[model samples]
Target: MDIGAIAAAVMLAVSVRKRLDVFDGPADITTSLMMVGPLLVLGWLVAIALFGGYREDVFGVGTDEYKRVFNASLVTAGMLGIGCYLAKFQLSRGFFLLAFVVGIPLLLMGRLLLRSAIHRARRQGRLQYRVLIAGSPAHVDEVAAVLRREPWLGYHVAGALVPAAHLAEETASGIPIVGTTEHSTALVSTEDADVIFFAGGALSSASQLRTIVWELEKAEVQVVVAPSVTDVSGERIKVRPVGGLPLMHIDPPRATDAARWGKRLFDIVAAAFLIVAFTPLMAYAALRVRLHDGGPVFFNQVRTGRDGEHFGCLKFRTMVVDAEARLAELHAQIGFEAGLFKMKEDPRITPPGRWLRRFSLDELPQLFNVLRGDMSLVGPRPPLPREVAGYESDMMRRLRVRPGMTGLWQVSGRSDLSWSEAVRLDLYYVDNWSMLQDLSILGRTFGAVFGSRGAY
Candidate 1:
């Protein structure tokens, strides 16, 4: 669809600008060449398809995939440019350039609109892929857990196929255990599975896997492999084939000096701009807090910043003056977890605090923290001293960059997310840190705040 849209737009632009003037002169070979234009458009479309632009995952999501589409389109245009020059065709190069620039954006906009509809359908459970797992009970459970976690991935686990050889008998994960692995392909056919995920832990031979792949292909379900590897970032892995055996290379995690410099520059620029823009909002919020609570407006608390450094983080005070003194008594309160504190219906909050917390007005004062260099405009969510002190090895990596007022946790689901999901999102941000990514997150932060689904 993207290619067709781009091609039609480009061809129309070219046809108009060139003004062929067909009735003025005798027809020539150039006319015939130009008349064969639809064929050229079809060729370009096929080139993009062959380059993987039409794949299911890339079809309707992610800037990364759209970037690929742009690259493929450019490659196709470059090839056409070479052919046009070789044939001495009387094509308007200026029109072609204009079309290339205009059409790509139009194509992307079309895809974006389509993706919004697709996302809505997925949310309503109208469009989803039915998948089945084949492995031992433990591996089956792991697969089911992952599927449940990412509902946006649009996978419904139909069942699990646990073989007696791998397990003692047919055992179940939370999802149904339909049958043994021996009849897995038949089960998939009967259940109408769209995908078959071979979860790790089954001791099936390569020959058996090959046979299963062949059989499942006949059933017309996509096959996917689940390696036992965990906590590995996709960017760190490379596949190299040597002597027909695929070798997986896991590069060591190394934060180099250049990347650090780039990150620091980004933090400085983003923080400075945010502080400048939010200054008036911060002052208004502080005045409201002070007028409402009849106390100091600023809430200052020591939080672990980058590399375990302590910094006084700022927020508009939403609680009473003696809220901290009352903390011990409220510690016994149920529904809120320790370390990661929450007081959804606390008595200490001022009357105005409820509205402030709902829209995240309390976080406006953190712009000062950003300006003071204690925090970034976007990074991991700043951890409380207690949370930082209890860090597992992986959690400490989040502190490599300055903490932020809003981050993965803020944009993901805020206070509503589970501890594990929060950590996973933070880790994902840390591993995939980029200036473009930070800007995208900051843009998304507004939508999350206004939605107010999880702020309180």
Candidate 2:
């Protein structure tokens, strides 16, 4: 994929340079490109390999792979430019810039698409690694649940080797208990495992753990340790070696960055652009809502925002005028939730409202809230005032940033999510959000909206 992207970039650069020959002095670009492209691609691959971008452990998850690719491409471009300058080769300054400027993104995109393919394959039970978990039964269950939650990680939990004292027939998360942790090596062989995860209570002492590792080394099985810590992003956690022991250093949450000028500027600009782009759609939604039983075109409800402030969250009317008045009737059907209240078949939703909600056209009015400083393009889901009132101490974390028009809760199953899971995701976003993560979520939003998997 990297080779293809680099080749395409070279060809594009050559064609672009030819078109700009009026000022760039590159009448015949193809001949030069043909001579230089392969060499550049070879060097680029070598650089990426040297940078550990192709490491197996970095695959299947995280942004580390993408970062390494970006770093490697930049370094390759630097080396090429320096080599050309030192050898007095006219590498066509415009061509040099265009190739890398185009190439790096293409390389990143290729990796992204490749990861999507790999995830799909893994989800279908292909390209999987047989896993042997070593931990206490409780800890084993925790590890298994995470793996189950994201099958695309490609770990097939064969069974668990728990502490002898805590042996059980199966983990609560449904992973069968195979043996005690003392026999991890034997079980790895018997189970034909490719990876062994050491969770809490995996070993009695450091020496015992060392012995197990040494025994497993001969089998060529990968070893991973899952600390009790969970929900921390890779960016916030750093490993520091002290006295031959590795200690994890977790940086403080960057939720305050949500209030920074850069993110605010990005929200303003992106929200404005989206509003303009979707004006026709928004207008149509408004007209349909207004024509439906003579109800108002927009629905505004008081929702809790950053710092527990109440703001009027705007949405195209997705229910009848007396929707709130009828909420008491369906409270029994939905179990009267505290955090997020939703129903698959809410009787109050109007006919047009159903269509608007499915594609998220109903929330189009919230883009104006984004422009009005009441919401953001992406952040935690806006909680109702009643929901905020019942929030536990931990749940209040979502109020640290402005409520979002669309958020992790929106993209990750939306109304289909349980209240606890939705709160967990929102808190995770509040703790770990970055501009890059926001962009990634925005990209995924299109798919989620179009697919309408969880929307009512």
Candidate 3:
């Protein structure tokens, strides 16, 4: 895949340069293609390899692989730029810029497609690593359950090894306890395990883990240690050696004032652009709502925002007039809980309203809220006043950030999420807010909306 991406990038660069008349003659173009392009491709591949792009640990898992690729591309571009300047190659500036601009997205898209195909294959029980989990009973079960939940990560639990003193009949998580940790090496050999995962606080001592690692060195099995703390971004964690011992230093999640201001500025600019870009669609939707039953075009409701402030959240009306009046009756009929009100198929929805809700067109008017500083482009869900009243102390942490037009909750499961699950996601976003995370969420929102899952 890396070779293919490099070849495609080289071809694209040559084609773009030819179209832009960058070459003085056919010989110049041919020489550049044969010499400059190959060097650039080679440098980029070497950078990617150094960044662990080819490692199996990152192949079918999280955004780490994509992040590395992006970083590698940027480094390659910088080095090539410097090399061109020092060597007086006099490369066309426009052509150089076009190559990277075109190539980066293409590389990322190719990897995304490849990941999807690999995930599909893994789901069909192919191309999976045989994993042997080593931990205490509770830790083993916890790790095994997590691995099972995310099968796309490509870890197939061959078995587990608990403490020798453990008297449990078997792993409560359903992975068989093949042997005790004392005999982990034999267990690995018997199961032909490709990877051995050690859950945090699982082993009896650090020396014991070192022994196990030493024993497995000759066996050529990869050893992984799962930290107890999860869900924290790699950017916030740093490893520093203190007193000859490696210690993990976790940075506070708080953003600097500059970052906060930058996010607000991004929200303003993005909201303005989207509002102008979707004016025609918004106008048509408003007309449909107005002509449906001669009711108001917009719906406004009081919702909680940053710092527990209340604001009027706006949306294109997606229900009949007097929808609020019928809410209680419908809630009673459908058995909706008092905290989060959601009915998959409600009688209150207008004909056009259903389509609007399905595609999230109903939320278009919230750009006004974003522009007015009552919300952000990406943050926690704008909570209802009633929901705010029901919040416990921990749940109220969500009020630390401005409410958003669309958010983690919106993309994850929308109306189908339980109240607790929704609150959990909102808090997670609040504690782990970053520009990259916000961008990732916004990008996924499109797919979620198109998939139309849990959107009602």
Candidate 4:
């Protein structure tokens, strides 16, 4: 894949230079293709390998592979620039820029497609590594549950190895208890396990764990140790050795003021662009709302914003004027809790309202809220004042960041998510947000809106 990408980039550069007549040297395509192209490809491949792009640990999982690819591309570009300058080659700047611009996305897309294929195969029980879990009974159950929930991670729990005292139990999280932890090596050989996962302080000490790992290594079995912590990004965790003992250092989940300011600037720019681009569609939706009910075209409701402040969140009206008055009856009929109020087929929705809600056209007016500094292009969902009143202390952490027009909850499941699940996602977004993550969420929002998976 890397070689193909490099070749494609070279071809594009050559074609662009020829068409534009930008190069000032002898335009010998055959010589350049045979000489410069091979050198460039070799250098890029070497850079990629040096940056750990081919590491098996990151294969078929997570964003590590993409990050490595990006780092390798940057290194390769830097090397090429220095080489051209030192050698005094008259390479077209436009050609170099265009080649890299085209190449990076092509490489990322190819890897993404490959990952999707691997995930599909894993979901079908193919290409899975058999895992023998060694931990306390509770920890074993916890790890097994997580592995079971995320099958695409490619780990299939073959069984569990608990302490001998707990061998009376038949299973841990539906995985049979095969043997005691003292007999883990024999169990691994007997079960033909490819990996042994130690969850939550499984071994007595670091020395004991190291001994186990050394034994596993001799048998060609991989060992994974899971820390007790959860819901933290790897970027925030650093391993430092103190007195030859490894200690994990965790950073706080707060963004610097500069990052916050940058996010605000991005929100303003994106909201402005979207408002201008979607003006016609917003106008038509407003006209439809006005024509449907002969009532207010815009709906403004008090919602909780950053730091628990109140703001009027704007939206195109998608229900009857008496929708609030009928809320009590509707809630009783549908048996919905006060935390989240959503009905797939509500009687209060007008003909046009249903269509508007289905495609999220009703939320277009929230761009104005974004521009007004009450919301953002990407953040946690804005909650009603009544809903905010019901939040637990931990759940209120979501209010630290500005609300958004579309958020993690909206893209993930929207109205179909349970109240607890929605809160968890919102809190996750609040704690782990980054510029790249915001951009990624915005990109996914378009597909989510078009698919309308859980919009209504």
- Evaluate residue 408 in candidate 2 and report its C-alpha lDDT on the 0 to 100 scale: 87
For residues 1-456, write the lDDT of model 3, one tens digit per residue. Answer: 777877787677767776775446442466655667778888989999998888877876778899899999999999999998999886766557777888888888999999889888887888899998888877888788778756777889988888778745587767888888888888899989999999854587788888988999899899988777655667778989888777998877642321378899999999999999999999999999999999999999899988888999999999988999998898788777767888877889999999999999999999999999999988888988888898999888888888888788988779888887788788778777788788988998998999888987
lDDT of 4: 0.83
Local distance difference test, candidate 1: 0.75
* Worst-scoring 10-residue span by lDDT in model 2: 21-30
Count of clashing pairs, candidate 4: 0
TM-score of every candidate: 0.84, 0.96, 0.88, 0.91
Question: Once superposed on the true structure, which residue ranges of model 1 sit more than 4 Å away at CA?
Answer: 1-47, 60-64, 76-98, 165-173, 254-259, 335-337
Q: Tell me which residue pairs clash in candidate 1.
A: none
Query: Model 1, range 1-456, lDDT digits (tens) per residue?
Result: 765686667666666545655333432334544554565567667776777878876765567567776777788788878877898865555556656677777777777777778776777787899998888888988877877776667788888888766544444545677888778778888999999888875536777878888886666789887877665555567889998777889866532321476766776677678678878877777778878858998889888888889999887788899999988778866644555776678889887677789899888777778767788777778888889878899888888777877887898789899887888887777776666667778888998999997877
lDDT of 2 at 85: 85
Model 1 scores a TM of 0.84
- The C-alpha lDDT values of all candidates are 0.75, 0.88, 0.83, 0.83
Residue 31 error, candidate 3, Å: 3.3
The best candidate by lDDT is 2
Candidates 1 and 2 compared: the better one by lDDT is 2
- lDDT value, residue 245 of candidate 4: 84
**How many clashes does each candidate structure show, in the order listed?**
0, 0, 0, 0
- Rank list by lDDT: 2, 3, 4, 1
Q: Between the candidate structures 2 and 3, which one is better when assessed by lDDT?
A: 2
